[model samples]
Target: MKRLVFLLSALTAMSANAQGSKKIKEKDMPAFTQFTYTGNDRIYNDNPLKEGEFYTPVLQGCYPDPSITRKGNDYYLVNSSFAMVPGVPIFHSTDLVNWKQIGHVLDRPSQLKVEESRISGGIYAPDIKYNPNNDTFYMITTQIAGNMGNIVVKTQDPAKGWSDPVKLQFDGIDPSLFFDTDGKAYLVHNDAPPAGTEQYSGHRVIKMWDYDVKNDRVVPGSDRIIVNGGTDITQKPIWIEGPHLYKKDGRYYLMCAEGGTGDWHSEVIFVSDKPTGPFVPASNNPILTQRYFVKDRANKIDWTGHADLVDTPDGKYYAVFLGVRPNEKLRVNTGRETFMLPVDWSGQFPVFENGLVPLKAKIKMPKGATNQTGKNGFMPNGNFKFTDNFSDAKLDYRWIGMRNWRENFVVKGKNSVRINPLEANIKAKSPISGLFYRQQHATFTAETTLQYLPKSEKDLAGIVCYQSETFNYVLGLTKKGKDYYMVLERTEKGASKVIASEKINPGKSVKLKVAAQGDAYTFSYTADNSAYKNLGGTVSGDILSTDVAGGFTGSLIGLYATSGNDIQP
Candidate 1:
């Protein structure tokens, strides 16, 4: 609808700049300028794209543990940003169907300390590697918050930045970084099968270490466990985490991720001569899966695997993993994404082309490339539309921020962007003045255009559909006693309610939207940019879903602000 009438004329100019003549007080904040998202998903408009073709999760929403690396015709790709805040999210491609995000490998803040974790505790499954021996480019991961276990970072230029985060004595959770040809340097991970060697509940274990890479650490005792309970530990395999290690041709491959990322996830393989393994299983072991299919199939795509593997420069081979796409009641509010295929490695165990069945949102472009998704900036799949206009003060790596990225409450004007509210409010686990974005489709529609004037109800300033800090939904503009309302709260496990409120009519300019279709969701607002009104009538997105808000991440939307306002209208 003309982008909803240019998002209601930028919220009627932020409600006429909040009734000019200054004097709004009461902790007045909210400035926002423009924001708009749109994603008509009927399984991406019932699948279209027939030029050379392109589309696969290829990164859609809530990007998950992808990890890829090439560096010749340039490939690079990464995902897994657990506590958000500019954490890992690099991208760039040559023809992997046109990618390009180019930023964030723990951008600053002393290499991301996750200001307070939660929201699925910080980082997890990262793994990006490239080392023509020393041209450098490594990014290992696993920081379930605090103690920041297993880290690593480097960059002989992945786009000109990186380095800081070198803590890896090990303990485990998806580390990786192989590099051998003659120079040697291993370090695979996913541990916990040593002390007592418990054999049941999701028994993990894939160890390996020797690394040192000129003192990046991990050699003290040279650990070794390498695939102990995964592919047929006699049918007890489970959560054998995201471990990668490949060598191919001289033999040595390990690959992992066995059931336990939901719906029995997979991607298995093994074979070794020695990177640090006696390895073997791979009689076609999973090779990538959709768990025996049949969960109501059709436009489905369930949790696939946690892969990583690359090779093009004419060598072929491709993999990248992570998957998800539930909606229409199957639940999973867009988390775990990034998907890719192609890899037949000509026998000796390497498969995935068509990855064992049922996953195809069109593909078939890779011959000479050319799709440049949503044009130059890449990142845009199927039905899409985005608009920011925060007019650059640097911000757009898909606008993140959660456990940290404070940058003094944002500001950046000339076009608009103002936030400054923070008394810690999106249900504080800490750090939140808002500015998120990653609800990338499954029926979408966001919107924003603030310029507030709250002054009470502890103050609040619009839009947020967040999915953590205890499931979310807040739609703003506060001030309760002397008038001016809007409200619409929701939260779910941390408890909250107020599902509706009205009393508007103050100095106008507000536009806040939110729409969905999968699990329903509605909420609306508008102050004269023409009709909208509907606060809380269709709710139930099943608590923004991670199959009921349990979280690994997804569903962001934000642009919020707060003074600690506690929902009440």
Candidate 2:
């Protein structure tokens, strides 16, 4: 099996490089730069990315609450695409570490409306920001359901499209975008100002408004409050939320992400002399933390904070934030990656030399990064192998769906992708013709290859492992009334059962397949392509985890369809 996965990835990179933090060695990993083939996506390189090192989820799976912004030598970043529908993802670094997904910011579905919203409820934390004297880029988000709160979108070319959402009446969740130093433009958020009153479970507050980019909105009365309760309102530090806004040397800092995000997530600081803030509280205040390394086994990296900070057009300072790594017993099925380091601003403030634990899976690259064309990082690039194989005609921009918006019902066949199964299934209410992409390796497998021929029983289709709409796992391909099975199904918490089945007969095609490794998921199938069959149990990738499918995205394996339910007993 590929030399037992290369001697079990070189004995787990020689037992994590004999216990120190900077290692990456499965033969200098990065999937060996090119020898062809990188199937189960191995490049978990335990550290070895040398010479000024580098390699850290520069942007890995479930990229959560990140929000970086740069514009000139290029930087971008923008995660937190809640109900997923091209909500807000956009990456494009020039080497503040490597990154490259370059597109997404509500890529239209009327620009801000997640078809009924559910799985972690629609786009919640976005920030982007780039107003080079009005060249414009702004993002600011939080739309748990249509335009009920913060929203603002723009683009001078967010990779070629964007601009439609502008509902910034603000109530808040995690919206940001600050441009002050004479250009004036603020938003910063966390919410609770419709005449204040929240004072408990992280009792909200860190506000600001005044936007109005030539009538784009948010400045009618100018809104207020810029720091309340976070940073010592007597340590009420609960869910103080991700609220970025920086500007050093001229002051006006204010970074957030307090206790609520798991294991008491952190990163807290404030400092104002203007940008509105009688703000102050940064004697290194939480400044950044691994929540006390939870148990500190040399820094365990528990749910660390939601940071932002950026600067590198020959400037240096870098941040990015959001962490999580637990694979088996500590359990986290990937759900929050994106972690970059560097930022010691000579200690006048910003720091991260182990900024209070967990930031060393190898880091360094940032003192005038030459923008390595090493083909957008985390390996497999030089030789390629992330796989799609439905034969492409356009759909390879990292597919996504679930809040529907795959360019008018997804059709692109000649090689395959004719999915028309739209009676809405996955147990309806929101699920529809899914078509995901983002399981970004912890070990991979994901298969597809169905041909379809069921006239009823809602003509289902196959292959999923998704993580929302009540957690998922499905295996699909049904017809019940005419007997054509291959189901497997799961769905936790919100409930749904069926574990295993097999009875197929549509022999023109059928591949299926699953196979994650750390949280388990196994399933298998095959018919026209020969030899495979092995479906039944082992589905617990923590029920599409976020602590059992609660959602912030990550775990969207792929391909789905459904029609079966018009009544035919």
- My TM-score estimates for the predictions, one after another, are 0.36, 0.35
Task: After the best TM-score superposition of candidate 1, give how far the Cα of residue 545 lies from its true spot, in angstroms.
Answer: 25
What is the per-residue lDDT of model 1 for residues 210-279, given as tens digits with 9 covering 90 to 100?
A: 8989989988898878777888887998889888888878888888888888888988888889777799
Give the distance in Å from residue 78's predicted Cα in candidate 1 to where it truly belongs: 13
Candidate 2 per-residue lDDT over residues 149-207, each given as its tens digit: 77777878778888777786656678787878688787778876345566666577787
Number of clashing pairs per prediction, in order: 2, 7
Model 2 lDDT, residue 472, Cα: 77
All-Cα superposition RMSD per candidate: 20.3, 21.1
State candidate 2's TM-score.
Answer: 0.35
Which numbered prediction scores highest in lDDT against the true structure?
1
lDDT of each candidate versus the true structure: 0.82, 0.68
